[model samples]
Target: MRHAGPKLLTQIAAVHFVSHVHIMLIPALLPVLPGLLGVGFIELGVALAVFNIISALVQAPLGYAVDHYGARRVLKAGLLLGSLSFLLLAASPGYALLLVTMALAGLANGVYHPADYALLAKGIEPGRLGRSFSLHTFAGFLGSAVTPAIFLGIAAVLGTRAALAAGAVFGAAALLLISIPGSGVYRVAEVGNKGCAGPVPATGRVRLFTPMIGVLTVLFILLNLSTSAIEKFSVAALVQGQGLTLTWANTGLTAFLLCSAAGVLCGGALADRTRRHGLVAAMAFALAAALTALVALGVLWDWALVGVLGAIGLLTGIIAPSRDMLVKAAAPPGAEGKTFGLVSTGFNIGGAIGPVVFGWLLDRGLPSGVFVASVVFMVLTVGLTLAQEVFMARKGRGALRYQR
Candidate 1:
């Protein structure tokens, strides 16, 4: 098989970055929108929800399309549609228009992971596939991390419309870059048989939907629930529930994000060295859960609070590459797009439900419940990871026995 090498990694990572930036653009502009559009925050919230729900509904089907049509074609369409969604946002004339625009954005966002992962699965060298996945994820996190500053800065200087227009420009540029020959994205058949990049059996009737896939999906949801709790509510919970200063609270959140980014880089290196991805995920989530549980105790103060939160971030970040590898291991041949697409829906599902669940706990004067719930979910993730390994091992043994 042709190895796409660094160029491909860079191209895919760039798209991942732009896609995340586009996804986050609306949220960054949210506070400004109510005044501009003459609507209430509740209405704005509903618009955002519509975008996410639509994206969730379409993710799996889009993944299937990636396998059928081609990753490059589907990915280009997603990029184009995502860019157009921003253009629509820039020109949105009313609340109804804004709602329609967000739905467009969701459709564009939904196809990304399936196509992106499919490309990586086929294009990247086997030894470095884990790092390739890491870079792809890291690019996304960087996009989210930078969106507030990038768009808000543009909005301040050039006006909101210009800022959104700038987003459209980014999508166009990504489309052109990936369209170039020697870019990482390839047609499915262009990939030669790279041995043991986690292959499924060839003889039997293949099934993409399996107990392992279901368990992996649930694992993704639970992991995101823990993360969303911290990302969305940790600051407020720290202030109101733990009586921490806003400065300290925000610092903890910031530390969590920064450390998590750093941990992703570290995890990539570890991923290249080992195939025991399930063990890596299990240990990381288990450690993260313990650190999160400490925060629930509310005994830490100031720096200690930030330190513990950072620890949780680090552990979870380390789990990411391993988690992706685990999913790749469980995938049936030629089903990369559909499998990733299906599992990634868990993120949207968890993200949709997490805020409400964690927010309710905070509203009810149970701040500790936020952390406690996160720990519970993380523990569940640990269990799922272990169970998935056992199941995969059994299947492997059964396949070998059948061959004999």
Candidate 2:
């Protein structure tokens, strides 16, 4: 088989990038949602939780769909439903309609990772898969960073309704681009018209659910929950609980996200350089945990807060590619979609719970609990990473050796 082309990478990355943008649109729009939806902050949080919970329930099935049917069909449907959800939002109906909208979006969002990763695995050269995975992750993070600017920036001038319309248009445009016949993602999907790739040698049907995969899944959950805690609650925690100004708090959050994107790039190069991805992830988590504990202690004030947040972001971001490498290393043969699908569910599970938990802490007048929770989760992730390393070693199926 020929090496996969750059077009495949771009197409898959584009799908990931667009899906993240849609996922983040709610957060960016949350400030104004209460006014529009006639609900309180907690109600808004519930809506977000509904989206995530639904996503968690469906992702594993979508993984099976990707293997049994085809990623192209699922991906195309995801893009369409994702767009429709925003259009429904633009319509600004009642709370019931909003819940339905989120459910549709959540179901659609679940298909992306399974589909995109499956496509990349089938298309990319083995030697370059790590970098491809990094680029894919980087695109998603970039999408997260940009969503606020796109949505809020537009809503500031135009109405929020117009902003939602624009988001819908964005998804529609992506769907059209990927649908084009000569495009890289399209060509690959066309190879198996039914959308399912031809059969490869089968491992056990349940092999994808190994203990190492479970550890990796938990690691993903902890990572997402920790990030969600920081992103959702840190600013308010700092301002209300720690006596920091809103400006400084927002600056810290921005530095964390921007530095994280930068770290993905660095991690991509580093992923290619070493096979000890488990060690790399462990070290990164340990440092991030320590820094987060400092944040929880309020040891850093003003400029120092921004500096510490940036450092934490960099350390955590650097682990991402290595983290992906570890999961790939643990997958049984021909189980790429199943493994990624299962592990990715951890993100939704965390997303489903993180906001409610952290928001409750803030509501109960426990701002310090936000950062404290982040540190605890990060520390737990470090333990899991080490355990995963030991498990893989004992199985004699070490990290990065399974790439082929």
Candidate 3:
């Protein structure tokens, strides 16, 4: 089958990957902050929250601008500001300065999602959206996942702040790369309708696809919460709860990430071809729940528990791209800003909530709580999936009647 404009997908994937790397820089770089600047968890967490809050605040505007304008102008400027923020964040003199830099990074991140999603939703064939988004999100996952190795190596050779400075430099390099000759140039504004480079014909109606987008937004948040908990507690569970060495714990986390990335590709490929995305996404959720419970059960039978937990990572990965596909399919015209921004808000909110809530559970002698909570979150997605189906069915019928 012919792919939907391979060049465009490559362009979007590159930006998506960079956006994720910028997101991952925090947890990777946070430890050095305290040793270098003499701050506490409270201060660090507060700064992190400030960054997220700022991103959340600007996302709506960013999405709106992208809808009105196009991805090229918005993406370039956001990336430039984000790169600057990374540099400033790495070298900030005080905690206050760091927070300000993070806030700017937040704003920068805000500008990418809406226009990017709109482009994919409009330009790519509907049948291929799953695989495309999966590939896109996987690039992001790979970028974020590999950063520690890159950052740590740089830190070992050039010191911590310099290592982070390197990340900023790399980000800026991505910006420059996009500007070169034959780099998939985007028109600032197209001459005749299609609202600027969109694949959809100008006459296509948009209201036919809104409510389903809303349902998936709910799923995005809930599923993100489970993934955030895994990131926060996976290593802790292995090291602290199971008494494995930190190195071993970290190794297990790597295994999980690798498997998860593979799962993303597999799931996206499957969803792109089949109407069973909901079922597949649901099953992934259930598997994640089961594996988390197995860990809580403590029937490890040796390192097998670690192995099974890696599978859980894979399940969430699958769920992620499937969720992305649902949103893309439901992405109506003229509302990319409202829809993508709302979903992104849900994601950021969940990211902020997961660590705090799961940390509390861990502190309170509740190993099972994490597993239980993840299971509950996944179960909730089942309801959201059903709601999406009903909404889509209704929309499809409305379209049929209109056609008749």
Which candidate ranks first by TM-score, i.e. highest? Answer: 1
- Indicate the worst ten consecutive residues by lDDT in candidate 1: 187-196
TM-score-best of 2 and 3: 2
Candidate 2 segments whose C-alpha is farther than 4 A from its true place: 187-199, 203-206, 397-404
- Consecutive 10-residue window with the lowest summed lDDT within model 2: 189-198
Candidate 1 colliding pairs: 8-184
For model 3, state the Cα shift of residue 63 in Å. Answer: 1.2
Relative to the true structure, how large is the alpha-carbon lDDT of every model? Answer: 0.85, 0.83, 0.72
Ranking by lDDT: 1, 2, 3
Runs with alpha carbons beyond 4 Å of true place in candidate 1: 186-206, 398-404
Backbone clash pairs for candidate 3 read none
**Cα miss at 404, model 1 (Å)?**
5.7
Of the two candidates 1 and 3, the one with more favorable lDDT, higher being better, is 1
Per-residue CA lDDT of candidate 1, range 310-400, in tens? 9888998998998888888877877788899999999999989998898799889999899999999999888888987777778889999
| Global Cα lDDT for candidate 2 | 0.83
TM-score of each: 0.94, 0.92, 0.88
